[model samples]
Target: MFPSSRLRRQRKAISFPAGWQIIPIAGKYWTSGAADGLGGWRWTGNLEANFDDFTKWGVGQPDSDMVKQRVALNFQSLAAVFWESEDDTMSMRYICEVEDSGTPTSPQPTVTTTTPTTTTPTTTPPPVNECNARKALFIVLESSSHVGSANFQLGKQFAADLSRAFTGLSTSKLGFLTYALIYHVRVHLHNSDSPEEIVSDILSAAYEGHSTRNTAEGMLAAKLQLETYSSGNPMHMVVLTNGVSASPSTTKHIADLANLVGIRTYAIGVSMPDSADQELLNIAGQYSDRVFKTDWARLDTILGSVVNKVCNS
Candidate 1:
């Protein structure tokens, strides 16, 4: 492939005994037979040797017409006795070697190399928190005028009962919020609130006396307030409503947002109207089992289940 002296040196190193090595054509020598006399080497190696070394061709061999492309070697007339490669396939001979020139040749060496590999250190991550235990809970009571005087009073009574039942909670950290036409926080987290304080605040809470009840915006307000308190502290909400809020879709949307931010909501509907039970179910999310529809009197019966659901969430 190049003008390398090593190739010429290797070629000139050919050596064999007196008769050298003549391989018979019928079984060995390359020939075209040219059944149709097309021009080209019979074998690929011969093509590599010299498709047609014009300078080494016999007098008129491979002549202009050039149709006959085969070869034959007659050692008796060493040089200038070459024939067309395709002359004849049956009567041809191949040259494997010639008499030794007695010139000493050098041996080549083989080299093997091994590369070094590198090792990278693996890193471990911190453990994940499943939030299966309660940390801080925010009570979101429906104080809207939509609940009216009687319904709001019943809601307050139910909340006070539920709050007292949260005694010795898995976590002492607790909070409180109320929403009607708007949302308001009655207690912030981390104050080490006692069960008595939780019940008192719920019972004493007043109704909003407003017609608007966009529960979703109220939930978002609770989320923002909880975020301000701390991060990674499991959050839970207990919403007491007598009916579906005016903006139910907005209520569901913010409930979903609260869920995405790791806050679990447990909606309680006491004496709810019509499809309001399922509406509360939607707001409660995966804690749908925590949703309740009962009169203020039976509200105490499910307080234990509520605490368990919140703690084991």
Candidate 2:
């Protein structure tokens, strides 16, 4: 059967020759979304080399609206570019350069040489430790009608102990925010400054009573002071309340603030029971690594422990 017709199946595949190379579209800023549509374009080895070259190109001038986007090697030496396919892909291109020999009277010889150097990426370290690091301590003193001067003295002593423990650590700063019936917050610069002066200033501030303790306002003030003074340094707050507030919502607000700002709240109950709702303490401990409970007898020890943990950590 040399049949009327013969049928043969053929498959065609596109491939590049041995020395043939892919030349990525030049200067076509492709966006990330459109990079996928680019077909048959392959990225060769050592992409960083291309990145270095692009970064050296620098940025363009702004428009009439004074708005401009710049391209440069960041601190990490990472490069960013938009591709032509409107695709933003981390890619670069290659160009083959040819040298021409002009009007050779005699026979001209061509020399080809290739030297590959091993490139080790350079890394930058973080900023050096500064002498101005500050730690904040929010002391909330809440005393009931039955509370005596001795209990207030105990609060002052606890604050003093805390100050002493943290003072030795860094040449930084310390800030005090006291909230009871009213708000009392102050920033203390401890760099070459005396702790006694700071304590005296704290003690001299007038005390205001609102007939109801605003623990929430106290915590908010703490957070605000931490943001204003500490500059994101670690904060430790000690709340000395003998009784629960007449306004329960304020306590809840305090808890929410502590949760939000990651401030450690250590609650000191003078004669109050531990079974009482310690939302502030719980929230503080959740943000920080330590939580403490103390009565009149073990007050100093508890304060010391909290200070040590905060400063050392």
Candidate 3:
């Protein structure tokens, strides 16, 4: 498998090894870094990897049975190199990327491969949650009229629930913001107060109830907040909404910018329409697992899952 954690929080790119097209097109080598997440296949590290691009997938690839075949590989040939579904247990070559700090202030990706070695098996430790690993999270709640009073309450509860979940994680930094016609930062990532404080702030804040859904503007504001109050940890953004923006393409453009800076974004939809779900998917880097959907009545059900992801992913 690929070194799953090396690019976990970095802005980097990965290209095929030089002359990779010559590699065996079949039964030769593939990478296991792409795995089946709860909802769909996801790259092990760096959500910014662009695995969501449909053009990168080979014909009939990823297969129909996403459950049993939990891993994916690359199929290389004279014509193309693309991804294909494979069994997780398969032995294969894996690719890894690292940042070349000497290149420039901007991130430059360089590939490095580790030769597989056989070693005596040992007890593998449990995965560390992101909260314990010093990660920063910013929650963006939609307060536009499109969300309505009922859904707005649910969004508040959702933020409050997350705050409670991350309250005692000493190393984690938390922030909260709301967007509609205007953007408001309820909490800063650098706030010395505990995450629990965010719960109160979120609940007490007034809803904007504006007609415009300035999702892109809110996202830009979030990027500024993270840059200004950076905890120097892996940063994540979660956007909760119940309606599509008037300009979803603008929101997607901002999302691409955020991803370029190593800010992984998750989109949660509350009883949103199909168009809004598509908008959320675009915001979530086109990954299904990163876009969670639920009605206001069942919003609480996904709170725990989102908390776990914020804590561990």
TM-score of each: 0.52, 0.48, 0.57
**TM-score sort, best first:** 3, 1, 2
Best by lDDT: 3
Comparing 1 with 2 on TM-score, the higher-scoring candidate is 1
- Best of the two (1, 2) by lDDT: 1
* RMSD of every prediction: 38.9, 27.9, 19.2
**Model 1 clashing-pair count:** 7
Model 3 alpha-carbon miss at residue 142, Å: 0.4
- Residues 1-313 of candidate 1 have per-residue lDDT tens digits of 1123423665667555565575533333433221111233322111123343332345565444332333443333332244443322144455442334667444348799956533221132122222344466677777777677666666666555555444455454566667765455666554555776766666666667766675754565566555555345677778877678766765776677677877788888877776677679778975667787776556656666666677676
Between candidates 2 and 3, name the one with more favorable TM-score.
Answer: 3
TM-score-best of 1 and 3: 3
TM-score of 1: 0.52
Q: Please report, in order, the local distance difference test score of every candidate based on alpha carbons.
A: 0.56, 0.44, 0.66
Q: For model 1, what is the alpha-carbon lDDT of residue 184?
A: 52
The candidate that achieves the highest TM-score relative to the unseen native structure:
3
Question: Model 2, residue 206: displacement in angstroms?
Answer: 4.9
